[model samples]
Target: MGVCLVLIVLAWNVVRLWSTTAAVVMSVVAAVLPPIAAVVANWGEDH
Candidate 1:
């Protein structure tokens, strides 16, 4: 859900600014954050 929000904002900015660099950077972040967020959110819960 949080990841979705980030992607949505990224899309909005990409569309609004039409900047390739911003798109690429946001795309990288959008790709990377979900797994990281999941790991952080679930860290140590199985103990």
Candidate 2:
């Protein structure tokens, strides 16, 4: 979560100006992180 937010903030505020493609890729990676985190968090849990 924290990492995701940081990535997004950097992507928009810093990386975008230098390279839109890199920024978009970072944003996409940030977007995917939460759900992956959720799945990892729940993995092997008993519900």
Candidate 3:
């Protein structure tokens, strides 16, 4: 759900910027951080 929201926002920005470079930067940020946080959160939860 959160990822979807981020994707929508990135899509909106991509429309404005319309550059592959900008999209890649946005995608990298969107792609990387959440999984890291999710793993940490899940590990803490399991303990």
* Candidate No. with top lDDT: 2
For each candidate, give its TM-score against the true structure.
Answer: 0.56, 0.88, 0.45
Q: For model 2, where is the 10-residue window of minimal lDDT?
A: 38-47
TM-score rank order: 2, 1, 3
Q: Candidate 1 — worst ten consecutive residues by lDDT sum?
A: 7-16
Candidate 2: which stretches are off by over 4 Å?
none
Local distance difference test, each candidate: 0.74, 0.96, 0.68
Off by over 4 Å in 3: 1-4, 12-17, 42-47
Model 1 C-alpha lDDT per residue in residues 1-47, reported as the tens digit of each score = 67767775876665448776766766777778888888999999999
Candidate number with the higher lDDT (1 or 2): 2
Q: Clash pairs of candidate 2? A: none
Query: Highest TM-score: which candidate?
Result: 2
What number of clashing residue pairs does each candidate have, in the order they appear? 0, 0, 0
Error of 1 at 19 (Å): 2.2
**Candidate 1: clashing pairs of residues:** none
